[model samples]
Target: MAWSADKSYFFMLAKLLTYSIFGIDARPVEVEVDISPASMPKTILVGLAEAAVKESTHRIERALVNSGYTRPVDRIVINLSPADFPKEASSFDLPIALGVLAASGQLETSLFSEYSAVGELALDGVVRKVRGALSMALQARANGKKGLIVPVENSREAAVVDGIDVIPVGSLAEAVGFYTGVLPIDPVPFSWDDAVEEHGTYPFDYSDVKGQEMAKRAVTVAAAGRHHLLMIGSPGTGKTLLAQRLGTILPPLSAEESLETTRIYSAVGRLEEGESLLLQRPFRSPHHTISQAGLVGGGSIPTPGEISLAHHGILFLDELPEFNRNTLEVMRQPLEESRVTISRAVGSVTFPASLMLVSAMNPCPCGYRGDPKRQCHCSPMQIERYLSKISGPLLDRIDIHIEVPPVPFRELSARTEGTRSETMREQVIVAREAQRERFGKDGSLVNGTMAPQQIRKYCKLSKEAESLLKAAMEEMGLSARAHDKILRVSRTIADLDQAEFIDVPHLTEAINYRTLDRSSWTQ
Candidate 1:
């Protein structure tokens, strides 16, 4: 190869647009490649790239050679623009490889100016799937790019975003051919309405539970208002069974809510292959041993955690007291704010965590304090210690507290089913519609998340209801927080009944939900 400083050398620089994911957002990056004459061939990757990204140079080179493309033998310098901030992930490999080919004058194409590419290259020239392709597609569309070229495995998720074409390529050769006009690939077809309607159904339902009708009703109220719920029962009491079916009784996810929730899942690589959008409400049941970072969302790069994964859905924590106390304590902020901000040395990132928290716990260390059939083996002090694992402030954040008792043989063996999830969901949807009318069409505000001022404005109690609540507050020694929670729960119950004002029946039901606050619970 011959190079002249004035002729060929001046044309050896190429720049292609790409994106890096930060938090749940996509940040633009320019992959700039420059080929200059050198005594010995070498390649340098200059940017604040983490080890995962820096390791892509070797992979991309092998992919280029295996794909029948030559690696530039000159001094090749690749820079990811805006080098101040850190970048991670192997998704940058495709764009960098294409930039090198274009800079070396081996591939001729004008698609670099119109499309953004994101995929990891395999050693055999196959383009592997990458995380955050949906986010990257959104960013590319926002930047006015024509389309986004992604791996075939990630095309469905990226195609979920409209207004921009999502070209699915299987191999590096296919991508090169499409860019060079040698191959034509159509954009993956997406029907937003049809996809959402087809995927909104859940497999579990409340009707599957044979007994515990009171717990079922309380769970319905919790879903109607997006309230956090806690159920205490002994082993094999249907607590876990009820929690799993909560999503079926909640409102089906709307389009905007589904997109917001799906983005978090896409950013964390949680989306299953071929799954386009998450139409059904998410139900995340994390193990009790999860750390604070795993629960909230944190890492060197700040990926979304389980709470964010459960956004616009339910987060069920089974065996609640078994979780580390500190790990559970960290949820206080996210529970109140509906978002968690994880600050690191690089910067701070906030992940949306608007979710209904459903938790189950035993009444005592022996798991039989309240069971009539089972004998209670734990001492009074041990019972108190077990219950004390859950802090009062955290308890205050939850809106509903109910006892789940063991199902008798008669109820379990009977063929008759309890209330169905479809019926409960219809009531929930009606209540949610009333809430939408009160709090605008966005549906961001619900009874469970009302502010102090909003509670005063919307939760107007009837005279009889007011009297009932006053008596219960004085007798139960309820905190001010618990007082507000009672009003919110009462408001939701009234909504379920399609009543304009909170009445005595609604207030009474709400007051009964504060079971743990009673003075004689530990005794």
Candidate 2:
């Protein structure tokens, strides 16, 4: 390699790299920087870099100088290979800076070649935490990297990635010391039990709700089957209370599910300060004013939205009808597909959105249309208009629709003798286990998300159960899609009872849950 006025010296240096945490699959990105000093003093970064990545030049230069390194003033050009793909974020600062230093003969590249580096660089050369540290670590492991150097703040998140070495670095000097073998980096060990001990049931429990046993039952079934639930009730009727308890009754996420959930949270920069894995299922309650993009996930650089954040968890819409109709309408596809694909002129990105939807709304404008104690002030037309705001297609997607009446004074003042969340959770877990066993052999799904073919094959009904379902469907004027949902719910009910097949009682209970559709059309 010879340096000339027109041709710069070519040096091929290898360094460990990590991928961006923005996209799905969390693929590893190789950060290859070609540093050459031939022309007049200048630094050029050549790659498909967004503003954040382009700005890394200033951060890297300041960091290198502050970290006691001399920058080659000779014209230096750095190229991040696979240059066609867009790179965004400050996480690349440390890697790009290290690559430049190594290529410029300031550091040994061989020492850092086996470990991926990801962090934001401060002007003072401190390593700051970057979003998607977990995703980066996972990508490092997948790419056969031996270790990862991440910011201390993201150490816990990166530690969740098993079978990989994660080194938490506080500053550029610490990272340099580890790479040069002057200072050894230790992996952060995480214990699931310790995480559980610290969080403790997430500060919300089913026992907190005073009453509304029917709504609780509906939610229990919803959790067991992963069904979408809609609760119609007046204000302060414990609808929100019941919705909050839905997560407690659900089963804990499997290791794979926890990782997937963590990836989405990391991508959205929602992973808590010290949290590694999201041990508990997510509960995302977006406000009614949220846009369709906010709900489904979209940006110039696509990021996980509320529904994606709620993946493998619960998505609760407090005032179901209050949400913009367009916003609600956009969810119908993801509800059926378990994922959302947002297309932009730049490109298209898909995000997982498999979640149990728990929505609540008033029966009428006055919030007293069906209340026993409160007199209805709204007219029939007003009530119809209010209910009509929720599209039938959206209503149809909801597997269970229950009317949550105000809790009786006696029950509210009672000694709270009903089963606690722990007990109810045990039952729900048992039911969910049965569903997992039944569905695990084929498609990865619970009862609620089963396909029509799965319903026909797995939700086998007895003669009596078939007759009961037929009569109910005819009476309720249910659609073909609703019919499958009924059978799925019936299957879950049978599983809850430890029954092998759908029976009359299970069908009866499943039919009872479709109260909204039955009442709305029948009345």
Off by over 4 Å in 2: 1-16, 34-36, 519-523
| Per-model TM values vs. the true structure | 0.97, 0.93
Model 1, 160-181: lDDT tens digits are 8889999999999999999999
Best lDDT among the predictions, by candidate number: 1
Compared with the true structure, model 2 gives a TM-score of 0.93
Candidate 2 residue lDDT tens string, 23-76:
554656677655545557788887678899888898889999989987766766
Error of 2 at 164 (Å): 1.9
Q: Which ten residues in a row have the lowest lDDT in candidate 1?
A: 2-11
Q: Cα miss at 171, model 1 (Å)?
A: 0.7
Q: How accurate locally is residue 515 in candidate 2, as Cα lDDT from 0 to 100?
A: 75
